[model samples]
Target: MNDILFRHNRPDRAATFEEYRAEGGFQALQKALADLSPDAVQQTVIDSGLRGRGGAGFPTGKKWSFVPRNLPGPRYLICNCDEMEPGTYKDRVLLERNPYLLVEGMALACYALGVERAFIFIRRGYELAALNLKGAIAQTHKAGFLGSAICGSGFNLELDVHQSAGRYICGEETALMNALEGIRANPRSKPPFPAVKGLWGQPTVVNNVETLSNIPAIVAHGPAWFKALAATPEGAGTKLFCVSGHVQSPLCLELPIGTTLGEIIDTHCNGMRTGSTFKACIPGGASTPYFTKDHWTVPLDFDPVAKAGSRLGTGGIVVFDQSTCMVAATLNLVRFFARESCGWCTPCREGLPFVQHTLERIESGRGDLADIDILREHVHKLNYAFCALAPGAMGPVEGLLRLFEDEVREHITGGKCPVKG
Candidate 1:
């Protein structure tokens, strides 16, 4: 209820550095610099149970710990602001409101990881967010929060923003690293993970914008306090849910991590529009599986959503109404994934388009019963691709086959899209 990230935000414009500092902003960074050790700050995060808000949902501190502290080189930190996911705009909104939060968060993170140089890999379209961050970084440097010997302590950090040329693949960590390195944006092989070797063959740590922004709050309030902010026992801290589509009032709001999908739609969003009744919703972003009425009460946390057969990816809730066609909707999503593919792997490069073609046949009334089987097969096959792109792209198709097979059949057998008619 205490609005951790948006506390200092203003509706008209981004909160200035003075406004953010006035409301106890850099206290966390000061505490870490003056009192807490890097390990201690990391331990607090691990205990708080904060997971990445960047779709994968990995534990934040655990990720930081993977960077070998003994490694004899400059460790790097990357703030992943490449928010290209469809219907997901929480990071952009957060930065537009209070960019200082991220600057402080990144500084704290850099201290914790012993990182001196860091980059904010922002998407190209987010010019305002990028501008706000650059201004915030300058303010922080002027205030002795960044640059060498920050806060009169021995810690040093230099932050820079790298605006991307805009590709969906850049959202992937390794692919992002490649883009930042001025190479083709394709995912690199893991196990020499980023924490082990990254960014010109140095130890690197990449964190999502929302994940890093929550650091100050977690530090200000103890881990237990942060954990208690969630509505469920397992969940920790609040989540920024960006609701879109058929809802009566579509907007982004910060709520407890375990808030129910039904609560978000009916209570927060004021339910579906005037005449539209809830048909189905993408509980997370475009890549997550569809959630039907049965999952209304399911908590929108990582584990709960996963158990319900969908990921709580980026907390981008896209709602659909009764009149919506699942086949057409899925086709639209598949088309996006197909277009955005980096063309590296065969399955993602070739299979996604094939899947799109099959979906087209079904949506256009030329599909056969055998085509249903073909779609199902590709759903499994695409999972074998190099990265998550193909598997994620197939999510809606899998959901369509599982939940809306009847409707798909209607399109096929009826020789036309029933919803369109």
Candidate 2:
């Protein structure tokens, strides 16, 4: 139970700056500024094997390394706090409980990446989290941990919180940059990737809140200690899991990486709710495929979850009971994604609605066997969409067609939802 993130979290309210510093908060920043070189800081994280916790699980240090050292002009660091994924709220919880962690982590990141400017692009409706962060930033500035010549190390950094106007697509890095720039928030194409050309065509490294928040600990404790915190050999660090739906205790908690799905449900969640039997779950967020009882023993890490036919997306575990209708559930998810589509491309803009329509028809008993094939077809077609939106939107549908095809078939065959009946 080596809780790296939540060790200092208070139960009732956010830990204040004074409390955080008293518990050794900015020591890592001081250590980095005083001793470690930028390259050394980056290398420590690289050795720690810390991957991005923001769905993709990309290597954090490697991502930082992408910024060309010799590139001209100012490089930027953005902590992506846009936790808009369905069933995902770890970022909000983390920020609400301890904003100082992020502040220190960002300063350390700024030092490591040669970034003088940084922004925390938070989603709308997280007012409390944003307010707390603003307070934390001001406190850090007054304490001389932030603002020009921080810690008397001659390292200058300015950090700000930019609350977004609210759009699911803003969670995507390119779209986020556009939104931050006061543009339309449409995702720009890659190849001129963000590390090289981002936020008005400058080298920018965008890390998730949880991802950056680990920097301070990684620097303070060394890579070996961080790597040893995982439950599995391959897993390098702890993960924040947001468990919701049909559980005795639905909560956001931190646990070692590679904890089994079965352990999380049966032990941590205290099993299903009274009189409810486990049917299935979205192992990660809504964007991932489903996990049935048969896959309970599967490790809930990036590679293992992917190998088990689902992505460990955002570590958002949404459970469903036997009484739940997989068809209706998937339809609900599709509806949200379709409504949230940026209309940037045809597949996500057009195909998602079509898939939604197809699912509706099946759920309402107006569908045939042919509609099933259509859903299958759109799942593949949407995967080729301009961005991850269309493909992510198709996730539940793909899982429905793959894991619960029988339920869909029953709806069509019985002329109604069997579960509803």
Best-performing candidate as measured by lDDT: 1
Tell me the spans in candidate 1 whose CA falls farther than 4 Å from its real position. none
lDDT of 2 by residue, 242-327 (tens): 99999999999899999998999889999999999999999888898899998999988899998888999899999999989999
Quickly count the clashes in candidate 2: 0
Compose the digit string of candidate 1's lDDT tens values, residues 1-421.
8899889989889998888889999999999899999999999999999999999999999999999988897999999999999999999999999999999999988988999999999999899999999999999999999999998899999999999989999999999999999999999988799999998899999999999999999988889999999999999999999999999999999999999999999999998999999999998899999999999999999999999999999999999998899999999999999999999999899999999999999999999999999999999999899999899999999999999999999999999999987
TM-score of candidate 2 on Cα atoms, chains taken together:
0.99
For candidate 1, the 10 contiguous residues with the lowest summed lDDT are 2-11
Global Cα RMSD, each model: 0.7, 0.8
For model 2 the local lDDT of residue 371 reads: 94
lDDT of each: 0.94, 0.92
